[model samples]
Target: MHAATTVSLIPVLSDNYVFVLHGGGSGAAVVDPAVAEPVIAWLEERGLELEAILHTHHHNDHIGGTPGLLQRWPQAAVIASAADRERIPLQTQGVQGGDRLTLLGRHLRVVEVPGHTRHHIAYVLEPQAEEAAELFCGDTLFAGGCGRLFEGTPEQMLSSLQSLSALGTSTRVWCAHEYTEGNLRWAAEREPGNSAIAERLAAVQQQRREGQPTIPSSIGVELATNLFVRAQDAAALRQLRGHKDLWRG
Candidate 1:
């Protein structure tokens, strides 16, 4: 079996996380880079070469760093949703759901998750040997919550979340933002008696107190504790989304 791909996080902007995927070699790929200076510094310091830039959506915060990174590594491929070419024009490779790609020697399958944006997409790195699977789900799904309905309906978000839920329990979810603490706090308020939410909130609180990222959450964990993922239907998800939009804590 091939060595498992290594994913490194570089926190940028206020709460966004840029993911760097690399294996045993110096070639690496970045996902949803909010900025480039830090990402460039990270790669240069490690002597890693940028081989590709994977965009989950065309949101500025998600794709703003592409131009700079392309300038630095002109040969790196820009992969994004084909339906969103107008917004994410730098994409050298336009892809859609079910498209397969081999980046940094790991196989990735695209999964359409259009809720945060009409053309939002995710990349699932198939598990190899003993390593767990990886999902780079931009702003669609969070640790204990989901992205707001910006350009899609509740039904679409529900469908998107359901599709992601089927990725298996062991898949490691790498969402773009650092909104876990707030998401869990709101979830605990909604499900006051849920021990899973309560316990996970406590653990996450400790992790935040230590300034640690609560990211790379497993699918099993989200299925158990995330209110959005556990919602029964579009109506339930809509209600939850509305409540979360107004929630201050």
Candidate 2:
């Protein structure tokens, strides 16, 4: 049987994702922690002590909580990409792209999704029989839009997104940032007649209004709607990114 999982999103700042993953009942691992107070409170109340942290990149919002969290759980290991350990100095375990790590009883396949940032990484969690594949991708692949080319080229971003697209169709895409509603809006505007984007936008709007997360979007959903993921090549992705940067809405 698939190992039970609990993925809870603790929203911090404006649009950051602090994903807390609990296995069955007790041990938990947090991904991209921004702030620690709320995360500490939520976990403590649930009797979940911090066991490990998975950092996708070295952005302040992503790694800032590491110090604070370590103060609480002095032994919890911090896992991040080994290539950029200087930037992500808080990490205890530096991993590479092909690393297969076992965290809280689940196997996490590390995939280097370096586009948004040169050394950005994503974790693909695969449980045993009957479990679903889950992707904890940091800002690289948003709902409809992709992250700005901050440190990498469009070619890298396009290739990265394509790699993510090749994951299991049922893979739950847990992307950081609450940009889905705005992304869908932008996508609909770009392709006004595209019914798939329009429908997804309508559904996303309802979820936002209800304060419900529109995330854990399946690979299938993104393949059908995410513009960046479907871009023909890096040039096309670059052109779209340029246009999106200019597009006010």
Candidate 3:
């Protein structure tokens, strides 16, 4: 039997999380590294060599660490969206929607999810023998809220979210930040009577009180409690996004 691929995280820059993927080997791939020092230290401590660096968008926090990481692993491939080359200029492998590539011996599908940024993309690592699928969605989809529409329209964001929603309920959503508690608190206010939201909020509150990270939320949980994901149309999404923008929570 093949060893299942493993995915882990390194928290950095306040709330940002950098993910590392490996399949029981000396090589690993990192996703949306906010900074390099911690990631490099994490990999070096584990005796793993960097094989690739995946970027989901061109935000400074998301791509800032690429140069530093490349300095350490000069030959490591930097994969990013072809359409956003002007912004993420250091990318070595430019890819688009539906494109497939192999990293750490696992297949990953590039999904064009442009809402947070015009050329933002997500990487969907396909499920292996006994491992569940993983979605490194950057800032597009959070635990209980979606990304603020910065460069794309409400319609585009709605479409982008719908595509991600179809990636299967079991897919593990590894978003880029540790914003679950705040997102869910806002969600509970938006949906006061929703038991799922209430239950998740209570559970998440306990987790936070214990100083734990509230991430790796599944699509199933989001479908049930994420008001953004449950928005029925563009107008609804627009209203929600507007409210979220002004929210101080």
Candidate lDDT values, in order: 0.96, 0.90, 0.93
* Local distance difference test, candidate 3: 0.93
Ordered from best to worst TM-score, the candidate numbers read 1, 3, 2
As for lDDT, the candidate ahead, 1 or 3, is 1
Model 1 scores a C-alpha lDDT of 0.96
Give the lowest summed-lDDT range of ten residues in model 1.
Answer: 1-10
Q: Candidate 3, which ten residues in sequence have the lowest lDDT sum? A: 1-10
Residue 213 local lDDT, model 2: 85
Estimate, for each residue in 213-242, the C-alpha lDDT of model 2 and write its tens digit. Answer: 888798899999989988998889999999
TM-score per candidate: 0.99, 0.97, 0.98
Q: List candidate 1 stretches off by more than 4 Å.
A: none
Backbone clashes in model 2, listed as residue pairs? none
Off by over 4 Å in 3: none
TM-score of 2: 0.97
List model 1 lDDT by residue over 1-249, tens digit each: 556689999999999999999988899999999899999999999999999999999999999999999999999999999999999999999999999999988899999999889999999999888888999999999999999999999999999999999999999999999999999999999999999999999999999999999999989999999999999999999999999999997
Instruction: Identify the superior model by lDDT, candidate 2 or candidate 3.
Output: 3
Top lDDT: which candidate number? 1
